[model samples]
Target chain A: MSDDRIGVRKTYKLAIGGAFPRSESGRTYVVRAADGGFLANAARASRKDVRDAVVAARKAQVGWAAATAYNRGQVVYRIAEMLEDRRAQFVEAVEAGEGVDARAAGALVDAAVDRLVWYAGWADKVAQVAGSSNPVAGPYFNFSLPEPTGVVGIAAPQESSLLGLVSVVAPAIVTGNATVVVASELRPLPGVTLAEVLATSDLPGGVVNLLTGSLVEVGPVLAAHRDVDALDLCGVPAELVTELEQLAAGSVKRVLRPPAAALDWRERPTPHRMLAFVETKTVWHPVGV
Target chain B: MNWEYAPAPESRAIVDLQPSYGLFIDGEFVDPGDGSAFKTVNPATEEVLAEVAAAGPADVDRAVEAARRAQHETWGPMSGAERAKYLFRVARILQERSRELAVLESLDNGKPIRESRDIDVPLSAAYFFYYAGWADKLEYAGFGPSPQPIGVAGQIIPWNFPLLMAAWKLAPALAAGNTSVLKPAETTPLTALVLAEIFQEAGLPPGVVNVVTGAGATGAALVAHPGVAKIAFTGSTDVGKGIQRELAGTGKRLTLELGGKGANIVFEDAPLDQAIEGIVNGIYFNQGHVCCAGSRLLVQESIAELVVEKLKARLQTLRLGDPLDKNTDIGAINSPVQLEKITELAAAGVAEGAERWTSPCALPEHGFWFPPTIFTDVSPSHRIAREEIFGPVLSVLTFRTPEEAVMKANNTPYGLSAGIWTEKGSRILWMAQQLRAGVVWANTFNRFDPTSPFGGYRESGFGREGGRHGLEAYLDV
Candidate 1:
């Protein structure tokens, strides 16, 4: 009897501080395809794993955010380049997890790479787009500049794993923020693979840290972490949004709630997302020498 | 001068007063659930204009429910073109009724008729027109290709610039397809109440625009209502902070246009005449009930004494009292409580060791009034300099260098606006950069256009109120 060629199995692990490692808790949870088939064992991240990821993000934030906007743009653009070269791998992972047709899955992979390029372009232009010189009634030069909001915690989308994850994660880092994301709980392989790509993209270490597991276990840890400056509650469980928001308020963390259910991720984005993750800083200098 | 001029009050006959007013909900006049009512008086004459119903918590809930229904059942389902037509209708009706509205606004809010007629009424109409055009073009406004509305906005406007502030909040809300429950300040609800009639005539669907007039308790109820999708407030910083704290976990969108103690800096090289004119328009306009009023003057130390002398002379020429008077430069205080607050703060300037100067003008005996006053010998730490009195009171400070001028201008927590007057083009640009205020008026003050974005920073609150940026506040994006 002839058998189909055996495909090589891949290990799914957490990527933090530029390296792939299992959860510090040494625990793993099985992720499955929509058809109830075994996909892979994703590292079940604990509070300790979150702490290490935040430390890496915090260590990497200053260097990444302070890098010239041009350099950052090139780094993110390189991520799209890497994503393009490995398109088939992402396509297979997206289909296994989403149960989408092979063509639809390929489109999703292509869209994710395109989104990275979109954000990469914004990296060099955000300051100009959001900043302006004010026409004050004075003899002074006043300008308001948009600055990166530090170290955001992302709860990436659960269903449209690759595209949605890329949508939320890229806008943030391209604008000079570092992120520690809890990738889609049900389907995290594509995200972990993207993190591997990020590791080699000349993107600084800890600039994009990915942990895969039960969001319920890791979400509260990231939300309540004092060091985390912002929380993107996009993929947080509906029931936990308000409670996590309450916890977020303790630190006055800038919170971006999930759009009303009707907001489509596949549509071309506007200027809103980048502006949401930045703070306007107005600086005044006397015009007279 | 008092003996020479006869009574020049603009005809109050133009304003058709109603004996009483009910809360405007779902496109109809309805009584408050609690049956509570308060008298709205003309501050200039101390005569009751009408008895307006005061809203209670239940009333707020009812208004929110109406707004939600309108948002879902009507406005939300309506085409953007249909919404644009409604806004356009409102704008046209406002222009037709501008004269009557101006008289009512002047009577109710104690702002001069000239200002109410030219500035407030025209601007109110202008906003409706400006935002009406934006209704159908929201896709180009940059939120998204198909931007969606956040339903049921709760807006609380202050007594100052009552109709214009209402227009600022309400016009964009409706244009963006969000229904709103607006609470006009109790002291000045007549024009806002009149606006409800305009909304009804414009054929805006039920629950799309509800005006509930009340004071702090009513405003608090509206702010704390769970049904509200967003809260837009233009009032005190203390109350703004309370709203911020109350909505902490609920994740309601909030935009505040709060109090400000803005600085008007005058450089020595400035055209002194124009600088003085800007200073006068800055602090004394609308009896100084403006969040962006240039209440603090930072004059170059070399020219400080001259500026003060000219400012004092300018004050003496200001026509105070009778808001209905077309010639009135400053009008009666809006209310007794506001008068006392102003009185106490002006006294505080004296107690705080700042030399005070009042314009030599007689205030009307029966009504609440305060003469235009300025305090000299003021430092940055003085109470008069540090707090927003919200009256036509100015404080003078001197700085030898532009650095000290910018430093002192930005010393306040309020960054609503600042003024820079200098001859050099580069200097104006440079000064505009350093002043942390949201609206910077170079060689101009107290200027607002429906097309220009306006709001404050820090305690002054968040969100721009006009231009394309204002559209973002009402949209779900």
Candidate 2:
């Protein structure tokens, strides 16, 4: 049975430099629903596209990292609000992509937004919680602050598309590092949709760039990127993890090792995740008259 | 004003330099299996202070095994408060014998006695005391509720400040319940061996802390040892890189406090006289052997001539001679290798057409000595401006505005430290944000505290030492 009225389909594209664009390669892949029905085409992100995303992310990192913590917190919080506004869209996308029941998909969307909110709150407080006024044995003022590790490249988790992607992206960017996220292999529609939400929020362009493509193609390109200061290999396919980790060491890039298996995206998040991508800076000034 | 002061040498009476020394392992002085021995000399006098055993792979293996057994059997299982008492005892004993250690350090490392007494020894003891209190409070250290220590730590220290670096590495490692096998610099292992005696006297577990002294091969063996879970190295960038390459696939945790060519930026509105003092302290302190020494000076173009004049005047007042002299402003270079590096870099500055001005002080003929020197009309691309000379040399560059000053200051790859001299508080804060250094000194320079986390950015290496950050490197989190 078909309805007389045809619905307007949304165009799915890669997010780079704050704009949605079709792949520079003019390539697209069929994204079928769980029932094998036709869905929107997802952009096939090329290696060049990932490089461009890294360039864009690097261009925006210093400004984003320089923003006041309170301002960054408010902007991140605004993203949660936008996600809340588009709540129905994510639930549908998750349900269609992952074959999840409506209730389970709804829980995923709620957790994603809540995760954004939680990371939003962390933006203003991570330094205080992690930093300290060192009781150094001298007449000097000493303090250590947790600073962002510049541009980060993340391989989004393959299993929990929305919640897992948000989990990795939010903690890294919440502390002021710009990110280039390679969406999940099996499921990416929810993540791409989340990118649309990030575009509309007050976040600056290139703060987070999303690319949808084959993990094998786009993952190693970012891992070897010279400008990318850190790599979170949480979603790298099993056989590729060791090679990527080894290549990452050429630049001495800070690495977050991939978990043994997919993490439970529904698990509560903590600040320990944020710490992996921060550099502690100690400042000392003489207490002179 | 011209009358020379009488010889004010600090007596080496209190320290009884042993004829020959053995490695301190498992609370016992043990001979190296290789039967090879090396002499540690006084750079100020070229006199062999003592002979030390050279540890080979077998010795490092033995030490690592001891530390592993101790961590599992004794030190690692001890309560934090109980550990705190042991550290407190070490700190007290250090204070009780700081004078003797200071003389030994000056005789061995060739740094002036006043600095050894005032800066190095006191700071070392202070660090032990500071981290002692932290032993019982790891739960609140931001890693986790019960952050567990990462087992045996293999530490390699530099000749510049051997004992201080040892304290920086060991205090926090012990505070977090880790056992250690420390390797002091080849030329300066006396104070570290002395501290090993203090550890035994404090009733610490036999195998908890071991001092294995030798050169590069010994340190390489320690780094390659499989039993060690962590490595803390304070040395040159080249050595740090080799260490980093060695641990690539091993998953060994490492923290490197490496080389730096820090910049001291002075604005036109800065207090002129105080800025001069800061400039002297920045480059001349510790004979400029400091890793975070402000070797580059960025002065405003409008006041560049005045700053150079004042700096030269201050340099003239600097006393250079015996490191044991209580009043010596600068001491002998640590070794002949270090002196050659300084001589080569200073000659490079002259060849590059920078105007050179060295203090009118005669160097001793027998030992390695370098007078306080500065080069003006320096371009950022010059070797003197870019390299870590690790000696008493300053490269002066001028900028017309605050923006230009920041641009010049951050041009280097090393970000270990930076100094900003400005009367305007807002301007200082603004510059602090722009400077890429790990430690930003607003108006003062060459200041260090155990509470301050110290390290670098870019090729200057990774991880921090000291403060809460120091504890994190030793903990599993």
Per residue, candidate 1 scores C-alpha lDDT tens digits across A1-289 of 3578788788899999998999989999999997899998989999999999999998999789779999999999999999999999999999999999899999988888898889999888888777666554445455556667778999998888899999999988998889999999999989999999998899999999999998888888898887887789889877878777766644546678876684556788776777877655444444554
Q: In model 1, what lDDT does residue B208 have?
A: 94
Give the lowest summed-lDDT range of ten residues in model 2 chain B: B241-250
Off by over 4 Å in 2: A1-12, A22-50, A135-140, A214-224, A237-252, A260-262, A286-289, B1-3
What is candidate 1's CA lDDT for residue B290?
Answer: 86
Please give, for residues B229-284, the per-residue lDDT of candidate 2 as tens digits: 99888898878867876875576888877889999999999988989999999999
* B108-227: candidate 1 lDDT, tens digit per residue: 999999999999998999899989999989998867779999999999999999999999999899999999999999899999989999998988898999999888999999988889
TM for candidate 1 is 0.75
Q: What share of the true interface contacts does each candidate keep?
A: 0.09, 0.44
Candidate 1 Cα deviation (angstroms), residue B78: 2.0
Quickly count the clashes in candidate 1: 18
- lDDT for model 2 comes to 0.89
